[model samples]
Target: MSALVARPFRLLGEGAVRAVRTALMQAVSAWTADWGLAPALVDVDVHRAWDGTSARALAWNHGAQSNGRRAWLAVGPDVATGLQQMMFPADPSYGPVGSATPALAAAGALQALDALLDALLRTSLSSQHNVPRCGAAVPATSWEYGSGALVARLAFGSRHFHVLLDGPAVQALVPPAAPLPALRAVDVAAGVADVPVSLRLQAGTARVGVGALLSLAPGDVIRLDKQADAPLTLASMSSHPLFHAYLGRCRDEVAVELVQSHTPVGEVQ
Candidate 1:
């Protein structure tokens, strides 16, 4: 006779699930701030299924009901092994009270999830290695609550993020490509306009022959062809010239200024 080996099972209780949702909201706030994303309004709650399955969902609401705008981002678990799921409402009939008209750019939900996940990784957070594949499915009707269209599945620790389209939505827009690493709230100041810039293409004279040979001396000087007052160039990830300013200290922290604009990064001009 052979004995079967049993595995330990852990289930989330009502109190524990509620606490987890609350913690997730805090995590979301930190993630947006760290990634320079327009912070999202977070709402977390616990949902249960009649079949004894229950889980918590994190909802990022973006829409207003008065203007027919409706869009939301929801992540929770269904009536199964407590895996995670993402749902997007495409129809407007069943909309949230203050939801804004959904926008096309909101389709970047997949990317947004990636940004949030990356932030989690940077913060050294561990997730269960049970992330499933991402996929989407469309519900039969707009008025049917909890109905949606699935787009695709994303891979998390053991769960995947799926995209769904059911209504108009707004997206957390990324700041236009800039020269500096990122734009900060303190970047905006009196007499300064926040713009993007990059120094990649700004032509710089390179050492060819004598400039290279003169470097052999211990105290040799190799002067750059550009003038010292020629607004020192700054760079972002794009082509636009953000702002030209010298670094300064504010409240014991280093800061920059948008002194002038040459060319807008990521823009035709």
Candidate 2:
């Protein structure tokens, strides 16, 4: 019951499956056009089927990684046979296949799958919304192809195949998403204009026995771990080191001249 209830949510993209499916199908169609092989995507979903497992597959790390990705392809006995018949130069029945079944006859099937996946990825990148697509633009070089690891089980027509993409390969396919309803600009000066902070003048240090410290009088001085004339560290109320300053006197009052900031310039106070 739990698995049944969770499957849909796991597969569906916040009720955006239709849109995602359509986009993926379009991308696949554009690529299969070269071979006149329309291997449509019958069903697609994101899953953790091969999250950390490695298997015999044509998989390789692709581009820089920023997120997770999984790609599955399934080609059943019949579909595998059909694909082989159409794509391979020599018939499956000829040469070494001899008496093997269609599923077993998918000779050079890995190469075929590699080409299909590569094409789909390129087309997918090209189909990005408003992303420039022209002769000057190159289809993304983000796909890392190799053999090992089962990432997905593709279901298209009557065929079933297991395809996988490593973490890096997935990164190539999906770009980092930008925040939606982008943050609006606002004046920040007023919010932090007047804030109280802890300004300390850390002099020097001296370690003494408890007995020696207790024996001290009002005229005694306990040194700290700092040095004379050393820079002072100003800390915020939150205990965050804020800045380094130099002890000085401004006009007639003692003050500290800010010497260096502890954080980046644009960081909020």
Candidate 3:
């Protein structure tokens, strides 16, 4: 005895769904005039399986290198009858020959359906190596149900129908993810190493009234905000402090010895 294992149903991603929907809508809109039928896309979705009991379907295969991928376009009884009536209106003068309406409508609709399949395949296989082509119509009963498939609902002159793409067909439309570039260590100091930057040193500051400042004469002492023992701030031209330094003498000339690095509040070192 052989054991049967059930596989989990995989739903189509958002990107794949959008792509199929857009392709179908575009194809219908483009060929509406030539098709002689006004078509509109109602909905596009994913379904586990298609119920073929009460629906008539046209099956086709397409692939880049081989015609192994399969898809189906199906319509309910009402849609089929509507298509028959639309393709062959009642001609009372031609009495018995009117019985052939169903067959004639099916044959005529095949061309339009094939065109839709071509449009979908062209869009999905654009990035692939070989251009995809649709094979001749196959028997709908021959189509094997997969774990899940994409189903598109379309309305043509009040008649609604469905287009289904099998798992392999849906996968063909999904674009491959691009590879990320390799990461490398960056030289933190190389780019700015040669750039010139101007720095300033601030010894102390004081706030005085305009009158008092104007009245100040030579030899008059002005008190500063900083303590005498405090180190001065070494900053950039923009007045951003970079370091703390103490005023000192180097070889009898005035100099500043860096005591510590200065970091502004709320700033990382």
Off by over 4 Å in 3: 1-77, 82-173, 183-185, 227-229, 236-241, 248-255, 263-269
TM-scores vs. true structure, each candidate: 0.24, 0.31, 0.42
TM-score of 1: 0.24
How many backbone clashes are present in model 1? 54
- Model-by-model lDDT, in order? 0.38, 0.48, 0.60
1 against 3, candidate with superior TM-score: 3
Q: Over 4 Å off in model 1, which ranges?
A: 9-15, 34-40, 46-109, 118-269
* Residue-wise C-alpha lDDT for candidate 2, range 95-186, written one tens digit per residue: 65577664543755555655655544443343222222222211122122322121444455555544333333433444455679968787
lDDT of 1 by residue, 162-193 (tens): 22222221111112234766656573343254
Cα lDDT of candidate 2 equals: 0.48
lDDT for 7 in candidate 2 is 14
Order of all candidates by TM-score, from best down to worst? 3, 2, 1
The positional error of residue 212 in candidate 3, measured at the CA in angstroms, is 1.1
Number of clashes found in candidate 2? 20
Give each prediction's root-mean-square deviation over alpha carbons.
26.9, 15.3, 12.7
